[model samples]
Target: MTKDLLMWDETLFRDPEVFEIDYVPEQFNHRETQMRELAFQIRPGARGGRPLNTICRGLPGTGKTTSVRKLFAEIEAETKKLVPVYVNCEIDNTKFAVFAQIYRKLSGHLPPASGTSFKQVFDAIARILQKEEIVLLVTLDDANYLLYENEINRVLYALLRSHESYPGTRIGVIAIISDMNVDLSREVDPRVASVFRPTEIYFPPYSADEARHILTERVMSGLYPGVLSDAMLDLVVEQTMKSGDLRVGLDLLKRAALNAEKDARKKIEEDDICLAYQVSKYLHLSFTLRTLKDEEKVLLKTIADMSSEGKEMNAGEVYTHAKEVMKIGYTRFYEIVKKLDAMRLINLDYRQGRGRTRVITLRYEPQRVLDLLA
Candidate 1:
């Protein structure tokens, strides 16, 4: 019976990888304008001139990373003069690690992990670019991580202002972030910040129609024909629209397909989609909450406790409660709460109307958040 249970069903997935977040479609819908603008910026490098730096800012799952990667593929295909090297700042968060990434991309080998000064790594990068006579188009994905870790200024100086030290080598930066209000003037040196006058390109979240279109495309490629019903697809699209995250839709699609496959069914039923939605929400919340620092977790605990009775909280109420649990000042508490809001863990509204004192709402269910913390 066990063997029969494992052996009996027809599969629905033609290529499961198509549902992955990193999958690059041949035709990227709703992002053509931004791609064209980025291509134009790097156009000068093909003629041996320095390209203007750019900042690609948008909410998460808005296709910023995918678009840059697709552009890199295009640049590599068409140009021999420009070399595109992409790095995720969350992993390569320091100046030394970032330079090591550039080095590996250019030379096909990593520099010794330690005992190599940053100056040595930078010099090696300078020598390689100068020798190859090739321009470097460096992309820092999740760039706000660097700023939060206080590593952005040194990295910026190394990339944007390196031409001063090397002479005749061109390096362009494409900094990607989810936050739109990241100001470099406050963190970086004035000289380096001046050189990095980035042309900002914003990627807005998808509307319901756009989300449905994207889901349709994914379903066609990822699952067998007629596996997912149009009504079921609409349900997934609606859920994603509420979240404003495309990944949520893709996750739902993948999970629902898996659920269908698990029950030896050829078609995805509505119940499968509903189960997938709940599972995906729980997984996302757990993953995010686990990444927060202890202090941030404590703040989340305070919010969860205060809102346990299903009451909406204001900034002052949380502030007063958090003070008793943690010995933090008001200003610092406000900053941390705003950071949580930026992370989409909570909703913070500052209104100028009467009787409104910075309303705060926990975006996730309070009990669910507490369970995850435990």
Candidate 2:
């Protein structure tokens, strides 16, 4: 190992060109079988075939998006049979926002965010597809968000039913939901749901050995050669499996690499791995808090207060409690709570088999969010 004050150019080492290295393979690993099956779904050009509705459910960074991208790339290269597009559902949470994203992406221009009429925006999208003579397979990544906003049905209706109005063009949906329980079929209108039965696949976290292989390959390929110890790779792989998040592994590698440079060291050791783990936790927890607005924080605290007082409630119930306790308007108060639910700072589950009056249950322990604010 080099001396702490060694003449290593930390910045140069800080940014190792990962892909240029030993082909960091996590983004593309153990996915061949899945990709092959996904191919036929998106390949609308096959005779006697129509558009396919497909769903991929997995933990964060389990390669849901990466796998789809890889499959689409193969489809694009080998066959011009279809047009493929992907959208991050988090970025398009609202009905209008989802429509706008599709419109702008297809039109090769950014849609007017608010001022333009909705009809004009959608019309432009329709015209573009017709003029280009393209059939699209739209992938919505992190699609559980659409359900939280109560916009999943509307979005599906627009994409699926569009063909009825414009027989010249076709739009097939490929929805990606992160959790196993996120239900797309339940959310779709029955008239529309019949047309939307998708091939669903689940992605499990890589095992310790598999994760180690994946992470080691990434470290060797992405970081300074010979920088990480065997122990460091093992620890990272193990922790990643525990977290069920490949992004956490990626974040650790990125942070540990930075810390090694900060210490003026050319090689990353086990201590750096420990530091990296702590830093990742700090950042993830901090990001969760940082994304919450001041009002959202206060409202969460209010929910925490109610939950602490032994009152179990749903969004509507919490909204009432928040109104009575804080004297905020019903509209503003409920809106903030919904945002909190969307952020995963709170969980909202409706009572099963219940009608329109069913409400949501908070998923996380209220104290956790409360402490973040305090």
Candidate 3:
């Protein structure tokens, strides 16, 4: 059989596994304080005491999920008193699904997906915990999705009020969210809120130097020494610092290397990095846009279409024009517009003028929207 010579030749990457999002490094820099605080909050669980519920909040890619995973690993390693179960609320946002995750984690198997009611799952979990003499520390990652689905209250009630159904069963939750502006106390049930006085731990955005150091560490571990240049690394750091998302930098590095490999190049150049950045931006924006409702997407398209250079349009003007694009009632249209604004997909500026005039502008580049929607 004929073989391709490049397969056996020197490659740009030494170990591509390090570039993966889930890859936890031996040295987790820039997040020691958060990690230590997490360990402290959950230490009581090791002694059969109730661990303090915690809220880990920050922007995406700021190590909220990573920190929690690291802590879970450490907790499991140290003692068997607490069972750490992690659930991504984006997938298991509902009470039944969330409880099923806990059931699976505690019982080593999942309850029947169908045929079994939520109360059954809840009771099973309680029985197992009481019999096993284990405290459950559940981490609800991407927890903001629960709030959007209006399931946060019920989910919290299920966890915080487990003791009501089964006495002496301790359940501690670590809620991870990207939106820090959300007021958890008001959103959750009053009873759950009173009990779930979480110790909030915030993961701030990485600075330029921190981003650089992180990218440098990843590059050294993931790629060959000479495959990426210092100048090229700077480009990634520059973009990451602006976005304040370390995920972007890591993604850019990995994608650029892949693109270079595709082009039969030995090293990643500036052009490769730039191209990867554009692709990454498009992917990120498209993912966010996909999450919007149909009405919101139409409103976003209208804003991108009607917006002019160095100027914004009034909400009234955009609404009038949006009807031309997609017909809808005024009240519903206004609500979708405000929803998009809240989602940060558009810039909504309320002007102080003769009337309560609100201006709206497309937050993203117009061409990008055209490309994605097309």
Candidate 4:
């Protein structure tokens, strides 16, 4: 057997960080229209005025968060008058947690984790913004998570109406919702909806050609020349299009290269791409599962186990099993099912039995879900 092994010091990656999910590329392509609209809404804050509240709606990996991050970077570089604070609602889904993020951003330290009340934290954030005469531009990425916890209304109400309570506190919100099924107008409270009349920006999935161009750009910037051939790159692009997520394509490129390296090969092959996809395809699911609470994970695991055994459990049946493991009411179980459905991890369908019974099904293979959960 002949093998072309790389030197211990040599690496195919020119910059491995480029393939990271959170690494924002310097040259963002194919979303010029959305970026321009986002900048326009945020322009006022940059110029020392209150920025307009905005809604950025799109599917997962559609560049909603990236656009906001890129624009926020530019805004911060331009002036200190506009403070851009990014809150990931996936991790900070509660009102106190959300404000604590802003508090940390403004004050350069987090509020006392256990002792600080939400009102105290909110007031401190408001006072700092008002005192500094700074406009607060906050991007709530994955704001849908807040909607799931029923905290969206409170968060929005507080942010939008802060000026009413603490006069001269300028704050604007850019709520990024990846779940297209979420309608803010219907989901938020009437008071929040009234004030959060935002400029809506939609990010559609990239076209096949666009995906090809973007993936090719990453190939050139992230990997060494000749490491990924055109044919292999096309295969990666096809897989990315199938997933409808650019992150998957990036992960595929990185994973395929690693697979090639492990085999003592300088170049990635079709087999490398195929093997990498086995894990990369679940990138979204993996991320979603990470954000879930412990109880939520228990419920999903129960459903996955039953589904793996060819058991189609309805909401009540799954609730019965799930509650056995975790103490939760049926209403909470139903909400978890809906939240999981919105996250695209499961299919929540209503089948007409005695009444309209909710049938639970795993969106991915049951084994795959169980393996990931494990």
Candidate 5:
């Protein structure tokens, strides 16, 4: 007789939230060095002084955000003098919107949606900090978004140099940059750079063993016992390391469990993992693409289309094709190519042929990129 299928009410997850993208695990392993360094930099804020500014550089899923969140939680639990605010720059990319987040965090309400100038918001936040004697520590998660929008200088200038305009205002910033190619020091304005100097903390990609240990921990906490076999766990880790992202492992685990459940099986099998990886491996690519501007997306598509002919296109050839779809000049096209390379969407290489020609190539399968763009 056939085994009974999983009922609608049956689930393999013990705590499904543990597999979520934003879930901060209780045991954050393999990042102790980064956490300690971050804490040391932020220690001053706990004692009513401005926290040292920090720049967290790492690839996607390298525990940077989780480290900041974990530290922020510890800070809030330990002190009243320091107020920690985490602003996702992807959502709040403007100077006004950033300060508005600060305002909301301090005052327990948002500023008026209209009729409030940036100066007004800045002054209000400054007054609150000065009056309360509270040290403000803001974490600009995904801060590269601010740099792209040309608001990094304005945001950093106001936060780092606020004391010049309003005496006794203590503020610090933690800028998290996921793009390892970006040099934060070279990207900011000189005046802002002078004060915005930060303690650079690098969170390198996890080693294979570390990735295995972390994923095993997640499986134990997130799923029921006997749901995933040892062999399948190794498969998930291998795929995750291949992608160089831990989130892909977590996603693969969750998806594989679901696939098992769909088959009314208590344990995940190799087929489950193989199928889940088909989608999980591209998690980082999908997220990075979502943040690209229209022009950037168009340029990427153009490259993908050109590369489908099975030849690596040089910079000049790419610009010629890109300009037809977008009204950008060669200089701007070159910039976009560099940005895409930084984002890991494409490979940018310089060849010694004819005065250092730039070679462009897509990182993923051209058809996969085209399908996603569609």
Candidate 6:
């Protein structure tokens, strides 16, 4: 059997284990103090105390969720000390749904929204909490989605105000936002916004040197020795940082190792890192495309096609072209185009002192869209 034939066999591609990556912080480092302070806030409650509300702000994969979860686990260990609840707002973003989650965490029941007043929910929680005497701490992850929907203040404001109903019970919010220092008062009530201002922790991206340490830590723990050359590791880490996300770093490394292993290669080489970059780009673009609406997709595709055709079009030109390409009218087309810009699927060219003129750039190559759609 030729080595190349064994290397090219499909069996290695079918290995299910290759798809999984360990997300533990030991394999991932460079955010230690941020993790420790977060752990300190929620882990201390000797039967009764103020529930700690911490806002964790950072770009995605700066270990925000991981650090928060780690802290939650440490706090949860003291059974019956302080009740810890973690809700992902991205998945359960509605006011009723988030409140319902809080209700379930505290009451162990999922009551329907109909015929149930917020007062009723609080009364029930008060009765239960007075009986059990537990401090309820809730962590809302990816909380910006809820705030964006305007449901945050409604639900959170109600809960915070619920002290009016149950004088002794405590409820606090831990909101996570992608932006570090964005002012929410522009959108939220001044009173409600002030209550959320106590403690804010920002997680910045690792420095290039720190990123290298993180990359090395993962490589040493997860891969065989000599599998990755210094050059290969640097390339993987470099490409990962280009996305401004660390999951990309970890994912690129994992994919490159699997690519090497697939080729019947014991030692992953630089070639595998290059292949992983292409694969990661394809995956990121595919993810971005999948999240777009049909109208948004049409706008993006129209822009991508124009860019492929070497036309330097502005926002107005793009919308004008969308009418010809997708047969959509001007009114709806402009709305879809704005959404695409907001989502960052398209880039706009604007002068500092001037208004938003038409010049814009398609964020992806047209052939990439075709490959993904195929």
Q: Considering lDDT, which of the candidate structures 3 and 6 is the better prediction for this target?
A: 3
Candidate 4, which ten residues in sequence have the lowest lDDT sum?
1-10
- lDDT to native, each model: 0.85, 0.70, 0.82, 0.90, 0.90, 0.69
- Give each model a TM-score: 0.80, 0.80, 0.82, 0.97, 0.88, 0.74
Question: Of the candidates shown, which would achieve the greatest TM-score relative to the real structure?
Answer: 4
Candidate 3 per-residue C-alpha lDDT over 1-374 given as tens digits, one digit per residue, 9 for 90 to 100: 22221254657888898887778887789998999999899988888988999999888888999888888888888888799999987567688888898988888899997899998998888888999898999999878767866788899988988888899899899999886667676678778888899998989998888778888999998997778888888888887777667887888888999988887777788889889888775545765676666777777887887763556688888888888978798998877776676556787888888978888888788878867866
On residues 240-292, what C-alpha lDDT tens digit does candidate 4 reach at each position?
Answer: 99999999999999999999888777789899999999999999888999999
lDDT by residue for model 6 over 118-203, one digit each (tens)? 66776777777667877777777867656645577886676666667677777766777764434443556876776655477889
Off by over 4 Å in 3: 1-10, 282-341, 347-362, 366-374
Estimate the lDDT of model 2. Answer: 0.70
Candidate 1 at residue 119, lDDT? Answer: 93
Compare candidates 2 and 4 on lDDT and give the better one: 4
TM-score, candidate 5, is: 0.88
Cα error, residue 101 of model 1, in Å, equals 1.9
Show pairs that collide, candidate 5: none
| Clashing pairs for predicted structure model 6, backbone only | 314-358, 314-359, 315-358
Q: Where does candidate 2 clash, by residue pair?
A: 22-221
How do the residues 216-239 of candidate 2 rate in per-residue lDDT, one tens digit apiece? Answer: 767766776667778777788777
Q: Give a tens-digit lDDT track for model 5, residues 59-96.
A: 88999999999999898898888999999987788999
Ten consecutive residues with minimal summed lDDT in candidate 3? 1-10
Candidate 2 vs candidate 6: the lDDT winner is 2
